[model samples]
Target chain A: MKTVKVGLGTCGISAGGEKVYKAFQDELKENPNAFVLKETGCIGMCYSEVLIEIKNGSDESVFYSEVTPDRVGEIVEKAILSDDTIEEWLAVKPDNKQNFIDNQTRIVLRNCGIIDPGSIDEYIERGGYEGAKKALTTMTSEDVIDDVIKSGLKGRGGGGFPTGVKWNFTRGAKGDKKYIICNADEGDPGAFMDRSILEGDPNAVLEGMIIAGYAIGSDAAYIYCRAEYPKAIARLRQAIAQAKKKNFLGDNIFGTNFTFNIKIKEGAGALVCGEETALIASIEGKRGMPKFRPPFPAISGLWEKPTNINNVETFANVPWIILNGGDAYAAYGTEDSKGTKVFAMAGKV
Target chain B: MSQQQSDNFKPFNVDLWKYDGQEGALIPLLQSAQDTYGYISEKAIDYISHITGIPAADIYGVVTFYAQFRTKPLGKYVVKVCNGTACHVNGAKPIGDTITDELNIDYDETSDDGKFSLLSVACIGCCSLAPVILINDETYGRLTSPKLRKILRQYKRKVKEEK
Candidate 1:
């Protein structure tokens, strides 16, 4: 039996991904066991949403793009279950369309568009929390920080702050309690990469947070994110619950002395709150306004507790860095910057 | 409490606990309150204040600070135009202007017939589809002048047909 994977991210849903999914569902109900339908997040091709890939349980796969609910029946019958592939509907036809994935190294978005984000098992099968395990079981807090520094990853959030150095500052700060925050509030209108990452791979970000918490000596952390992203928010809530049940999160995680927990604080539609100090205030239940920082979030933040804040893409890169030595990650980018940059690819690109 | 306020306040009573005592809970509470009611009513603010203990004045400051908050009721259909960098580069101002013109109201104002509301939103991250306008959940991107007019007319026609 052939299996079908539909891109159901917000972009996809907005462009009738839900209708296409429903159409497939309606068709599958009548003709069960012919095709296995699964949903994946956007693969960065927002232009061609309502995308679906049909796999014939073998090496062959055809990605049908720009698919509408009206066209679902024909695509399923002709392309998915049958031997002949529909060239017209295929987003990238053999020996025709330029393969967009070519010459692009996708680390942060490795599992994205490739797996069922709703399924944590798929994340694990693709080596999800193994970075947390490696960090917890073998590496010390200092070592983790050192390895991160060696990786040479600057923040992808446009500030370009060196992540390891920031982590080190928080780690060494003179405070009784320190907190780590994943700034998932991709408030900048153009930066959909963070939201896409969260929607596609919540565990990777969660794992990254676990590693950061262990390194920074924080017991608790919160992801300050947009509530507008209901799907991503729902997935994250589920991922957090699953992590605790699987012992990937919670006290003494991975059977180590270190303990950590993460919470999700829904950002209530404020762009200014994307700034670190403002984010802290918003999390503290105040107006999302920027503030002057003599004491940056690193020194004093989140109810006057020392907090380390990193952007979504920054933390999203953590598990990969920890799993594959920092040097391996360092090898990808220039001297000034390191690793992949996941641009949202919006507008007239 | 007024009947309208009480009706809208039901969904948030249980959910507000997750944010209890957290100073930052105010914004999310206000947001939830806004979601419950089409707009943030005076009673809604008081209802939120009663539950979360945040002052109505402070809530008003927060609501006013952010553009997302709507003190007044909205139309049945909300047309959110993207005014982010990419959209700006792609002539979003004219698109926004066209929307305001077509709707026969200014930005953030609903039509006289109460069928459509026009608003400008920050980049919704669909940059690839610049010059995009979201009508409710559906996004119409790469739009042109004629297309925009046609889309507007369709909305009007749909409302008329329903009536």
Candidate 2:
């Protein structure tokens, strides 16, 4: 059986993806057994949203770009029913938009636009929580921290700080309780990378957070997401619920002595909260104003406890680094800067 | 307040208990009030201050500090123009100008009839579709001044048809 997937990310929805999905439903209702319909997230192609994809057993998937309600009939008739290809609508055909994904390494966006974001099974099928399992079950906290340091992963939230060093400091800090914060307060104007990841592969981010919790000797975590990205928040809420049910989060995960819990703190449209200290203050119900950096969150932060904060993109890279080992990630970029960077390219050009 | 204005006030009844004594609950409480009432009124601030034990001055300060919070009531349709770098480069100013000229109101001002309010946001995260404007939740992108003018006319026609 073939499956029909629609892009339902914010960009896609803004481009009338809901209408297109409704059209597909109306067409497929007569033959309910014809194709399985599913929803996916952004493929980083905000320009050509309302994207539809057709997939068969092991064959290469096909993508149709800028698909509308009016065009749903043609796609259903030609692609799904007849099992034929349409060249003009194809987004990944030769000499077309193929280089968009081909030219880049997509570790953070690996499951985005491919797997159903709402399905935890789909995420696990893509090896989602294996990193957290490996960290909690096999490797020691210091060992996990060492692997990250060897992997040379730095914070992807534009500051370029060494992530492993930050984790080491938080782990070394003498505090009764430690906290891990996944900074999802992406306030930068052209940046939708964090939003896309949160909406697309939320499990990966959750797993990443769980691993970070284990590494930093923390039992509690918070995702400080902005209120602007409602879909991202919904997805995170759903993912957290699913993980809790499966014992991936909350109380002795993976049958280990370590217990970790995650909570979501929605930023009330404050741009300054993107700063670590400001974000900590906002989470504390105070005004989101920047403070001195000597405390630096790793030592005394977040209700005066030891805290480690990493960007959404930085946390998204954790599971991958844990499973693949640090050397595999270090193989991607220059000596100083390892792995790929996600850029929000926008403007007149 | 007039009878009509008093009648329009609906108490924010959703999850008020969740924030009763929670620290860091001030912003979320204000956000809930904003979502329910469209704008944060003085009475709402007073109620929130009373409930959360935050000073009314502090609550007012926080409300004015964030661009998302509005003290004034918004129009039925809130038109947010994107003024990000990409949108700016792609003639966002002209689009905003067209909205203001057609609506007969400047940025951050609602029409006297309360039909439309104009706001300029940093970005809507749809930079690929530059020069975008969001009316409530719907996004109109890749827009020209003429196209925006036509869109505004359609919204105006909607109000007229209702009348």
Best by TM-score: 2
Give the 10-residue window scoring lowest on summed lDDT in candidate 1 chain B. B1-10
Using Cα atoms with residue i matched to residue i, what is each candidate's TM-score against the true structure? 0.91, 0.95
- List the DockQ of the predictions in order: 0.52, 0.60
Off by over 4 Å in 2: A95-98, B1-14
Best by DockQ: 2
The superposed Cα distance between candidate 1 and the true structure at residue A172, in angstroms, equals 1.2
Docking quality category of candidate 2 according to DockQ thresholds: medium
Question: Which residue pairs clash within candidate 1?
Answer: A189-B123, A284-B23, A284-B24, A285-B23, A285-B24, A285-B25, A346-B127, A346-B128, A347-B127, A347-B128
Alpha-carbon error at A36 in model 2, in Å? 1.5
Give the clashing residue pairs of candidate 2, or none.
A285-B24
Supply the DockQ value of model 2. Answer: 0.60
| Interface RMSD in angstroms for candidate 2 | 1.6
Q: Best-fitting candidate, measured by lDDT?
A: 2
Sorted into a CAPRI-style docking class, model 1 comes out as medium
What's the count of clashing pairs in each model shown?
10, 1
